[model samples]
Structure formats: structure tokens, C-alpha cells
Target chain A: MIEPFTVLSSRTVVLPVDNIDTDQIIPARFLTTTQRDGLGRHLFADWRRDAANRPREDFVLNRPGAEGARILVAGRNFGCGSSREHAPWALLDYGFRAVISTEIADIFRSNALRNGLLPVVIDADSHAWLLAHPGAEIGIDLRDCTVRMAAGREAGFEVEPFARHCLLNGIDPLGWLLSQVPAIQAYEDRAACRA
Target chain B: MTAPRTLFRKVWDRHVVVPETAATPAVLYIDLHLVHEVTSPQAFAALRERGLKVRRPDRTLATVDHSVPTAEASWASGLGEMDHAARYQVRTLGENCGRSGVRLFGVNSARRGIVHVIGPEQGATQPGMTIVCGDSHTTTHGAFGALAFGIGTTEVGHVLATQCLLQRLPRTLLVELEGRLGPGVTAKDVILGVIGRIGVDGGTGHVIEFRGEAVSAMSMEERMTLCNMAIEAGARAGMVAPDETTFEYLAGRPMAPQGEAWERAVVEWRELNSDPGAEYDRSVTIDVGALEPQVTWGTDPGMVMPVSGRIPAPAGAGHRKALDYMGLSAGAAIAGQPVQVVFIGSCTNSRLSDLRAAAAVLRGRRVAPGVRAMIVPGSQQVRAAAEAEGLDRVFRDAGAEWHQSGCSLCIAMNGDRAAAGQYVVSTSNRNFEGRQGQGARTLLASPLTAAASAITGKVADPRPLLEEGRRIA
Candidate 1:
């Protein structure tokens, strides 16, 4: 369901680490299953591992404060490697609606939005500010592409007009293509005639 | 304003099957289809699902790479019962191609090498042809003056179903290089310099045509290395107009037609250059003589500077964040960053040429202790060729692991990965965060730098190690 009004949850899980790759987001072991269910339990499956290769409780995501986090506050260049759609798929499946980072990888940024996850860029000071105010909530209005954080702090970020429009309309690129069925049909007819 | 004759316009006009309109996608005529292990599975699956055949299957060539277990799994016994991701992908490629009557150059096949390397070596890549692959580094094929681009699975399906697809014409930029490169500076430095000047997104929607005196003088392999990283600057594709060098490289390959056909092909290829009055949307120029060997300090291809230059202080939010996360400080020379691992293999640089370059460095040197070094050949054919020349033995004797061919450290989609916080000097295309593995730091460089780093156990210039005997065979 597309919610008319959305707010970034205050319960943020900070991964203040750089170069968090797609495989680490969802390990290859969990990828064998085709479906999207129960992926949340396996998020950060490899990094959260103990010396015995079991889930490490000391990992941030396993901590009580970060359980069921919907907004992931990550370090710089988050989602930098791989073109696997599974990375965003797993992140979305695990209930993360927004990812706040200093820099997002080029493909990963586009992939996240297409998969219905929002990627936000905040300056280092803002990032530190958010980390300091752990329970600070930010209200994200997709229509305006603006984030309103606690204590009256607000920032204007940009999303591609097409992507913003698509997210608001709950239309994937393929779905957007289908919406232009009339134009597509006409083009096909003209192409056939030319042939 | 004088009418700008852009590289994109010239190439686009040459290949345009139908005129452009707001409603219709540009009808691009494809000349070759190069496939590899990582991206072909889904395309083949789409073909099977549609109950369609690969249109112009002869134009389509397949080679195995990516997901190759180049380490311990180089032997078949090592792959037993592992159900490794690459093993499945390799098997799928073989089975799918066999069923479809498309050629699958398997690891067992002598011709199998990195797709880009094998394509050019066999002369499948030629001028004025459009090439597409599922993998991004397909730009490597552009060195032959063919338009090339990476496509998604759906686009792959579209190509498989019809042997053609609708595409938007890209804006063209003429990136002119001036002056001779300094000694120790190579083609890698040239492209890395271009990327540094033009940020990653600078070429976002354009096709880059490299020109000028310096570029025209490069060898085919060097040209491929430059074009391969076009995607790094966010270009749709890149091309170098075909010339004598291009013609020479294709002369004896098996796929290239001989006799009158070869003559005719060359005649046609000579016309692939941009017309004098062609128009371009934009242009950028670089003076290569001033550039030094480059190394990346931050998480992006754009976050690179000359090895002699210090890491820049974070300027934008993105830059600051990238530096902080990489645990780097401003003004620190990138040359001496202690590398935890060194990887030299990928579609970008895993050819016989790349191997020869690395081998020249590894000939008498020992890898620094506590530093893991691996050299995965781009293809099985490349592996054999290296072994034939004792390059593999050189690597092994120098304390580096000689691996079977595959896209080993490029994306690490298979089991091969670096542990968290591990810093890797890699020859792969992108050094984006976690590209090698989760929390794994990647420093992008040419194979020479990767091998040199492997030997010295830190980021070091490869020039000294390679000066005497490392002319690319």
C-alpha cells in the first residue's frame, strides 16, 4: 500500500562504516531462496557473525535499540558495489524505508528508489547531528522531496523528477511503460508500416 | 555558434536505422553480441520464457568469466558438492548455450578468455558495429570504433528476442588528449585522469569519443583499458575511431573474415571516423602530459588523484562522508596507503596483456607477508596462455595465488570476497564501496599498480618494477 503521508522513523540503526557492499547487506547464502519473506532476520547476516560463524549479538543491528529499524543511517558511500537488485530488495524487505548516507553509489541509488526505498544524502554535520539525537524523527514528504527533522531542522534534497513522480504514483519503470500503452501501440504500428 | 560536430552525432548518424522522434526510440542496429557468465543467465532465461530464439545467433558470442573460482577451486575437485554460485552460473551458461545452439566457450575450451579479451583477439569486435553485453565493462569493445553499452536484463531480453532494441541517442563528448604521457604514466593514468577531471556523473548521458595525438598512438589493449572505464565517468559508451592500429589488431583473428571480405571490411572501417563537420552536444579536453599515475582514496572512481597528490579535504557532503568512511585524512598521499590485499583480474584488465604486465613485476619479487595477492585470469584461454609462458609460475613463485579465469574480484558475486575493513588494490573497473565485499575498501588502479602493491605490501608505483622488461607482449 502507498501511504499518503510518510515519516522517517526515529529508530535509526547506525552503520558508521564505509563501503558496505550489497553482499554484506544480504549474504549469498540467503539469496538461494527466491521469495522475499523472512529476509529481515538475515539482514547483515555475514557481518553479524561470530567467530564460530553464528550471528554475533554484539552487532549494532542485533542490539535492542535497533531492532525493527525502518531508517538506516549509514556511513559514506553506502551501497557502493554490485548491480544486484537483491541488495535493495533485501533492505526493503527488512522494513527499511529510507537510507541516510553521506554518499550512495550511482547504480545503488537508482536501484533503491526503483525498489520503493528512499535514499537521503545528509552532510557530515547533519549526519553527526542525527547520530547525536538518536531518537530524532525526520518527516519525509515525498511530494516536496524535503526532510523535516526534530528541533526545527529541515533540509531540501533532490530526487530525479521522474523517480520522485514514479514513487509518488507507486509506479515502477515497467509500470510507467505500461501506463503509456497507447503511445507504445501507435509506435509499434508505425514501425510495422515502415518495415 | 559554430555547428558542433560531436562524436555521438557522427556515430549515431552512421548507425541510425530510423530517424528520431519524441515518441519512437532510436532504432540501433547491433553488429555483435558478447556474452559472459554473470549476465547471460537471465537473458537466456528470458529467451526461454518467451519461447524465442536468439536472433542472429551467429552475431552473438559467449565466453565464461565472472563467478569463476580462481583460487583453490581452480581444480574441479575443489568445486565438489559446494554448490558455489559461480559453479551454478558456469553450468547454467554451458547448458543454456548448448540448448540454444549458441556457442559457449567454456573454461574447458581453449578459446575461452575474458569476453572482451577473447572478442578482440578473435577479431569479433570491429569498426562501425554496435556491441552490447550484460556486463558494464562492455565499453572495452569500443576500442575498435564500435558503439558499445551495457544493458539490463530486460534490454538483454529485447536484444535476444529481436537482435535489436530501441535506444535513446546519447549526447557525444569529444575528450581530446594532448601531449605525450610521461614515463611511468600509462593508459590507466590517462583514463583515471579523465575520470578525476570529470566527476563520475559528468558523462551521465553522453557517449565519449576519445581523440587527439596521444590516444591514436596507444596499443589495442591500452585503448581497451581506457574505454573500459568510460562507464566510470557515467558515459553511455565510448569509442575510438578505427585506424591502422585497429586494423592490425583484427588482422589474423579467427572470427574476422579474410581475403576480399577483410579488405572490404577495412575499407568500410576506414570510414568509421567522425566527419569533419559533425556536431556534438559537448566536449572536454585533457593534457595527458601533466597527469601522473592515479590512485583512489575515497570510495568512488571520482575520488581519485595523482599518487603524488594528497587526499583532498572533503568539499561536498558526499566527499566528506566518503573520506570519513574510508578512514582517510585530507592531504595524505595515496601512494603509501597500506593495502591488505591486492587483486589483478577483471574484464577491465584480465587479458593476456594485463597478465604479462603483472608478471613483469612479479618475476623476481616476493609478495609482502600479511598481504594477500591473487591474480585471476579473465578466461580459461588466458589462463592457459599465461601458464604456457610460465606467467602463472612467476606469480606463484612470487607468493601470489595464481587463479583460474573468471570475474573473480570484480564484483565478488561468487564466494571470493574480502573480509570487512580490508583494503584491496584492485584492477577492476569500479572501486565503489563494498564492490569487492561488504565493508571492503577498494583502490582502483591498473594491473601494474595492483601487482606492484602486491609485492611491496603497500600502494606503490609499478613503473620501477616494470621498466626494464615489461613491454606488453
Candidate 2:
């Protein structure tokens, strides 16, 4: 079991960039550790940190008001490259509980959901509004599957029921699959019989 | 019972262990799981923490890549080139696979290579199978008509505890490539063209089946190249129907069925293509008769144009940001830009054929004085095959660095990287900022283009060079 992700209410940090790939989220050089902890420091290692290994003050994450923001508002096709769960690991560890975009890549969405990071795909209007209004208060309720923002504007998003249940209860999907061995074996046995 | 089914549906239907419901995903049994040093370490750690043994060791295969240094050719030194943490990740994978009874082609093994390359190299990938890995390019196996996709470490643990993944079926998108492909237009160009037509997110939440005469005519390796980059278009997986080319390539591989079993397998595989009248959620057709060799000018693969084209001005802030990261001016010619390095290896284009293609261009022609060109074969096997053909000598004679096989410079790990802010013409899959190195600018292209760029020390079209060879012949 992991941290239950039922609701999140926090100001959003806007990085209005499209197709923010996993490499940009966390470069491949930092992917050596077998463990997932301490990755928070390396989230967007290249974008957040400058060439001299100093934090660039211009980046949103280093700015004063950006502290404690839990929602990330990015452009379309966020998380577009590499299936490294490190992207979400770094995001979650760095205190981002949700990423809002108009289009979230397929594998990244699955990875994010399995890791308790809500990949919120909003409508173009809601996405545009979110991008235009960074630091705006937004609330997410996994039960209703809605992302509620300022001025009563909200968008309904989709999360597979099983993934939603897993996120809501802080249950890892592996345990559920582990419990269904008999079914898996039965299916394999049937294939053998047919063969 | 008589309804037509897509090839993807056929594969997905056969792999179902338990059907989906309102509260649960379908239990999809995996026939093969490819593990590499970088992604599987954490997944194995999770299994060890839970005291769970791998459910089906026979179906699981492991290799060391992404962290294995291409510079280290001696196993006796034993991956000594890797730093502490990278070495630890590889060693942990070795220990975990040893304890779990899974076969690991470790850094010490000659068969070691990129996970995607050796999976097919070993014939572990087959038609009508369900395949998964922790790397997004697992779609490479779909060239064999398998239902393959990448998963996260959590799902990797699930497959370890049970050789099955809980997945919601993805909708199907049919991409049909017709017309005659021109010279110097390899599979890499075809895929880049597809991604250019369809935006980066065009195939989001879908599995794409590449169909038509152009796909039918492609070699198995070429098809792998095409399917390998479907992820660049946000596709979960990419597929091409198994035919003569597929079976012919699989016939003598290590794990393929032998003799009578192979005959029976062939009979069954003959039916693996989609049936007539198969329904699809979406369809698109691209005419490749006039298609030219393509190159990516922007960071995203979708931001590409023909080799003779100019970089388009930014349409939005996202495009502007990509242009800034790429360090290219708007309206500038995509060609003739200075380059410091040229990389000709990745899961996308590191096969023996890719090596041969690059060697063909590099033969007798020296890489420009300032350019540092590196040619990394996709697998040890590919390296051996290229060496057998004297391809390595051609690269070396052309002033390129010939290295051992691994995902070198493609992911920018293993110290195989270009310096910051330097431009590189690479034959890898992604061109995201800091991908080849911190602050490095990447212009993604095919092996031929990379070879030409190495010779010119700048981005250059390969058509004239290729045409010269053909005309001489």
C-alpha cells in the first residue's frame, strides 16, 4: 500500500511547455540508483539547475511563490518520452500530486496512475485557463473525477476504475494481480489443452 | 463468431487471462518480459521487499544496457567503467535475476545488448504474443505482430509476481503507408514522416497498426525501426502483420521453434494478419511516393521536416520554447548547421543493416576534422556481424569511433555524451533537450544522414551522396 490520493487542493505551477519528455523531467545520467528516494532533488535536474550546479532563479520551481505548489500545469503532450517511472517518482517526491495537461501521453499516464500521481487531462478551455493563471488555487477530487478551479470552472477527466480504486485506497495494483493466480493459471491451462 | 477482428484485437483476445470490469482491468498474460539494467533494478527491489519470487522465470529475460558503457569491451575488467550507483544497479539486477532464476545476459555475456535488440535477436519475440518491458520502446517487438507495450516498475512487479499485467484495452489506429519510397528514405524517415503528419499526441491512448504496400515491403528490421518510434507519436504500441519476411527472419534464431514445431507455428502465424473488413477506431493513409529523407529540427519528433526544408517559425509558446532549447533560428535552413558529433546507434537504428548503411557512406570518406563521430552497433551480435563484413574498419577508416554495443549517446548515460550546447546529428529516437547531453542540441536523422553530417561537420542531405554510389554502380 502507498499514500492514498483522494483529494488535492493546492496552487498550480505553470510550465507552459509542450511535450515535456521524461528526459527533461529527469535526465538519464541521474537514473543510476536502484532506490527511488532522494530523486526529488533531481526533478528537472537540467531545467531547474544551471550549468554551474546552481539553482536558476528564473525557473518557476526556484521562485519564492512557487514553494509548496502541488499541481503542475504544462502544455499538451506532457510526459511524452521514455517510460521511466522516475519521472513520476521525482514529481511525487518533489511534492507534485497532479499534472494538468490537455493531452497526456499514454504510457506516462499509466505510469503516473500506478504511482499515485494524478495525470489530469483537462479540456482545452480548462487547460488554457490553468496555463494563463499560474498560482491559482485548484482542487481535485478522485471520487468525482473532477478538477475544480477558480470561478467554478471544472473539467471531468478519466481514470480507469481499477486505477482510480487503487489510488483512492492507496493500494498497489500488483497485489490485486497477485491474488488472481488461479485465473491466470486456468487461462494458461486452457490454452495448453487447446494446443 | 464470424466478425472480422483487427490483428491487434486478435493478439489481445488470445492474451486475456481475465476480462475487464467496471472496477478492474483485464488481466493480460505476458508471454515475454524484457528487462534491462536501468529500469528493472527498482522493480526487482520491490519484489525482494515483498519476498515474492518471479512467477514464470522461463518467460522473463534480462540484460544489462542503458548503463553498460560502450567503451568497456572487456568483461574481465567487469563493467569497471560504470560509476558506483550505475554499477550497483547492474549488480543488483544480476543478483536479483540470479535469485529469481531468470536468465540474465549480464555485462559479462557476449549476447548482451539493448533489451529491445536482443529480445528479437534471441527469437523470444514472436507473433501473437504479449510482451512488456519497463522501457517505452518495448513497442519494437510489435514488428513481429505481438501485442507489446512498455509498463512502469509497479506493473513490472505485478508481472514478476504474476506473468500478467492489468491493462485496459487501447483503441486501434490504422496507419496506411502507400506509394513508392524513394532512395535514401529508410524506415527512420518513414516514421519521422508519420509523426510529422500526426502531432506528438495524435495517437494518444491508441495502438497503431502500420499497414499497406510500403509496410508490407519493409524488412523485419525496418519494421522494427518503424514501430520503435510509435511512442514518439504517443502510441502505446505499433504493429505490422507477420508475413514471409517475419517468419524468414525468425526461422533460425535461438529460441524459435525447431523443425516440425516451426512448421506448425508457421501455419498458425500465417493467419496473424488482420482479416478483411477489420474495423478500426481511426484510420490514416500517407502517400510515400514523393517522400524525402526527413530530419527533426525541433526537440519534439513531431517538429520535423524534409531534408531540403527550413525550420519553421514557432507557432506557439511551446514551439518557441522548443526552438530555444534546440538553439536553432526560425526560417533557417535545416541543413548546413555546424555539428560537433554524430551518433549512429540506438534501439531505433543500431542493427547490422544500420551499421552497413552508415559504413556504405563512410567508406573511403573521412569524417570532417572537427566532428567526433561514434558508431555503436545495437548488440554484440550486430557488432560481430558488422565486423564480419568489415563495416567496423570502414567506420574507423572514416575517422569515426567504433565502440562496443549498448544504448550509447542515445540516452546520454554511460559517459557516452557530447559536451554542453554542442550540436549533434544523431540516429536515436528522441531529441529532447539535454537528451544527448546537458544543453546539447540534437538533430535526429537516419544513419545515412548522420554519416553525411559526420563527413560535412554539419547537417547535410544524403541524397546526392547516396545517388553518387548508385550511379557509379
Candidate 3:
């Protein structure tokens, strides 16, 4: 059963830097296995490893209150490099329901929506505000494309109408097409000529 | 009122078949189907499970890339290192393609490279065609005016079963690239610059037709690099009109037609260009010469600036929030900043040309004392070609670690990665926060720029290094 889009639990996880690729999201070493399981444990393979190759407790994800955090308040260009769906799969599997960023890589954005991960794009200033105030919970209303803070501050965003429709219904592009009977029927009628 | 139609819609509308009702699937005729090593295993297994042959094998092409080792020594050990299960899956893909009579560019084939690379080089990526592969970068084929997108394993099975799948056409966005590309700036920078201008989600719901002199002048490889990253900007797909450069690149390839047939193919291809005065739902133009060798300052590709520029201050709501989260101050110059690591490889830029370009910078120079650098080839073929020219030696001599290719450090799905809080200069695409490793700082740059940065132990412009190379021009 598809899950309808709803307000996601949003909060900023501050990293304070740039150019983060998938390697950091889920390290390359974990890719050797076919199983997608256990990836959540090794999300930041190299960085999380200690001098003796143990998990580093200082990592944001390893720190207090960050475990299983739903909303990822991240830096610009949220997903870049490699068209791996696994990056989103890892993020989703790790319990992030939404990613708020200033920008994203083209492929990562597509994969995100298809996998049911909502990527919200906010302006730079808003991103900074959220970053500076960690644990500041935010709410994203998909129907309105608005992200609001608990403090009553709100920002309107723009999402493709089609994407918005799909998100609200928890349907992908193909799934959305499946919902439009008339258009599909028209297409079928036209396609009957080729048959 | 009738809206102006886009190429994607026209092509999509022409192929969609009606289902039993609106909720039923609209069967779409797929013109080209590309397959690679990682995702085809299960698709083949399902066919065998059903005792079904691949439908429309003529439209299907397969290749081995990921998991194929780059060097002979590595190839042997890597193959040996693969668990029995992984080996079985790879062999199954090859055997199934063979039994189904699908053209398979296997490990030993000279034509084998990245699945995306093989398509356009061989003219299999035709205009007005809908191409799909299980790999997400399949969008790379769109550069030749095709409507290409990636599918999952289940969708792969559907395409194999019907030679058609369900899809709706995307709206069109015209992205015009004007002016000239500056020296040392390549197609990678062009796409990066686009993502930077539009932000990542700007092209959602649209198929982008890239135009203007800058796009027209790019080689098919360069064009593929551009279109490949379109998905990064949230575009459904990205394409360029077929032109002489397209035809020339297709000529003489193994799968491409010869002589008169080729001429006929070109005649048809020439007509694939968008009509004059075609309307786009949205259009944006970029001046190319104004672009410098770009580098990602924040995690996203659009969080980028000229190599000489500083990290942009968070201005808009999103940028500010992202910067605050990233713990970076606004307007910090990225140049001359120390880096602990550097990487060069990915579907985005790890081709022979990118390696050669990086080598030109690293040939005689050594990486900074403490900085670690890694060079990974995009495919086995690229590795072979690089080794043939002794590029590997050049990389090693400069204190760079060259690894067996399989989406290394690019995604950290393999053993390569950076420590937390470590700063890196990488040639791979995307710089999303925590992309290289959680809490690690990623600075995205061209391969040459990455190499130069490695030598200087800081983010540095590649132009000076290129100027020092007498043969670069």
C-alpha cells in the first residue's frame, strides 16, 4: 500500500561544510554485499571508524538526539554524484522522511521522490537559520508547499504541480498516470491504431 | 486553448497504449533498452523463472562495467575476491543475454565501457526514441535527443517482458547555453554551472532540451556528461538535438550502420531537432565563457562557485538554513583552504579523458605531505586505455592511490571514504552534506582541479597547472 504524503517531522542536522557526496552517506566498503541490510549501521563508513576502526561516537548521527532523526537539515546540493538509488534508499532506510536543503543533484532529486523521500528546497538564509538552531522542529505542508517552524515563521516553496499531486497521493510519476483514467484511455485509443 | 507541445510529450503520446481503464497501465513502446552488470541479474532470473525469452531482443543491449576490475592484477584478484554469489549473478546476466540473442558487451569486449558510454558512441541512442536502463544514469542517452530515464529491477522486468513499459511524457524546458567555455572548463563544469543557477529542483516535471552554440560544439561524450547530470537538477530527462557532431561520433562504431544506411540514419536524425519557435514551459539561458572551473562549496552540486570564489553566504531561506547546518560561515573563500583528501572517479567524470586531464596536472607533482588522493577509473576499458598510456604510473608517481573501479569513493559503497570533518577535493559529482563520509567536507572540482588541489594540499585553480603543461594546449 502506498503511503500518502503528510507533514514530516523536520529538524536540521548541522554539518557546517560542503561538497558531500554519497560516500559519506553510505561508504563504499558496504557496497560489496548484495544485501541492503545493515547499511544504516555503517552510514558513514570512513568517518565513523575510529583509529582502531571502531565506530566514532562524535559523528552527528552517532551523537545524542540525532539517532533515527526523521528530518535531515543538510547543506546545499543534498544528493550529488553517482545515480545510485541506494543513497536515498539508505537515507530512507535510516529513518529520514524528508531532506531540506538549498539545492540537490538532478538524479538524486528524482530518486528521492520516487522512493517517497520528500526533498524540500529552501533559500540559503532559511537553511542557515535552521542549521544554527539544531533540534528546532519544523513542519512541511506538502499540499501548500510551505515549511513552517514551531515559532510561527513560515516560508512558501514551489514544487511542480505534478510532483505535488504525486506526493500528496504517495504515487510516483507512473503511479500518477495510472490514476488518470481518461488520459490513459485516450492514449490507449490512439495506440490502438498501431495495434 | 491548445498548448505548444514538447518533444517528450509528442514522442510519449505517440507511443502510449490505453489500459483497461484510467487506472490501468499505459503501455509505452521502448525504442532502446540498455542493461548493465549490477541491475540485470534479477531481471534475467525472473525470465528464467518463467521460462520466458527476452521480448524484442533487438532493442536490448547489455554491458559489463561495475564489478569488473580495472587492472589485470586487480581483475584477477577482484574476480577471485567476489563471493560465489556475486560471481553467479554476473555470469547469469551474461548467459541470459547470450541465450536471448541480446547484444552483450562483456568484460573482454573493446566496445564495453559504461553502458551510457557505449550507447551514444554506437549511435544506438537515436532521436525520438525512449531509452531505459536499470541504471539511473541511463538519462545520459537523452543528450542525443532521446527520452531516456532509469527504471528499477521490476520495471526492467516489465520492459523485458513487453518491450514496453508504462510512462507519461514530461513537460519540456529549454536550457540554452550561450557564449564560450573558458579554458580548462569542460562539460562537467557546464552542467555544474546549470545546477548552480537553477538550484536542484528547478527542472522538476520537465524534460530539458539543451541548446545554443556551447552545447552544439560539445562532443557526444561531453554532451552525455551534461545530460547525465540533468537528473541531479531534478529534470525528468535532458537532451540535445542531433547534429553533425552527433552523426560524426556515431560513425565507424561497431553497432552503427555503415555507408548508405548510415547516411539514411543521419537524414532521419537531422529531422529530430526541435522545430523553430517551439515553445517551452520554461526556458533559461547561461553564458558559458563566464563560467570558471566550478567547485561545489556545499553538499549539493548547485552549491558551487568559480574555483577562485569563496563559499557563498547563505542568502535565500534554503541556502542560509543549509549553511547553518553545515556549520560554515557565509562568504568564506574556498581557495587555498587545506584539504585532507582528493578523489577522481564516477559515472560523471571518470573516463579516459578525465584521467588524462588529471594526469596532466599530477605527472611530475607530488601530493601534499599529508593529503591522501585516490584515482578511480569509470570502467574496466577506461582503466585499460589509461594503463596503455601509463597514466597509472603517472598517478602513482604523484602519490595518488589508483583503485579498481566499481563506483569507488564516488558513493563510498566500496572501501574508499574520508574521515569525519576531513576536507576533500573530489572530481566525482555531487557534494551533498555527508556525501563523502558523514561530517566530511567535500569540495567538488574537475579532475584536473582535484589533482592540482592534491598537490597544493588546498583548493586551487587548475589553470595555472595547465599553463605549466606545454602539451596541454
- Candidate with better DockQ, 1 vs 2: 2
Superposed by TM-score, candidate 2 places the C-alpha of residue B418 at a distance from the truth, in angstroms, of: 0.7
Local accuracy of candidate 1 as per-residue lDDT tens digits, B1-473: 64644545555665555555654455565668877766567667756755777766776889876655566654657556444656777788888778877777886777877787788877888777788876667888889888887764555656666666556666788899998987767788789889889877677667899999889988888899999988777777889998999899889788887988889788877877777877667888888987778888887787888776788888776678678658788988888889999999887788888889888888888999999998988777678788999998899999998887776777775567888788899988777656677678888888888888998888998877677545543
Cα lDDT for residue A133, candidate 1: 68
**Clash counts for all predictions:** 9, 0, 60
Measured with C-alpha atoms, the lDDT of residue B343 in candidate 3 is 88
lDDT of 2 at B177: 98
Report the lDDT tens digits of candidate 3 across residue range A1-195: 237786775565666434355556765444444443455666555556764677778777767888656888777656655555557767878888788888765556656766677888888878888888887777888878888986788877766455566678876454343344455455545645543
Which of the predicted structures, 2 or 3, would earn the higher DockQ when compared with the native?
2
lDDT of 1: 0.74
Interface RMSD of each: 5.9, 0.9, 6.2
Tens digits of per-residue lDDT, candidate 3, B125-157, equal 776788998776777888877889877654676
Candidates in order, TM-scores: namely: 0.77, 0.98, 0.74
Worst 10 residues of 1 chain B by lDDT: B2-11
Assign candidate 3 its CAPRI class.
incorrect
Let me know the TM-score candidate 3 reaches against the reference structure. Answer: 0.74
RMSD of each: 5.7, 1.4, 6.3
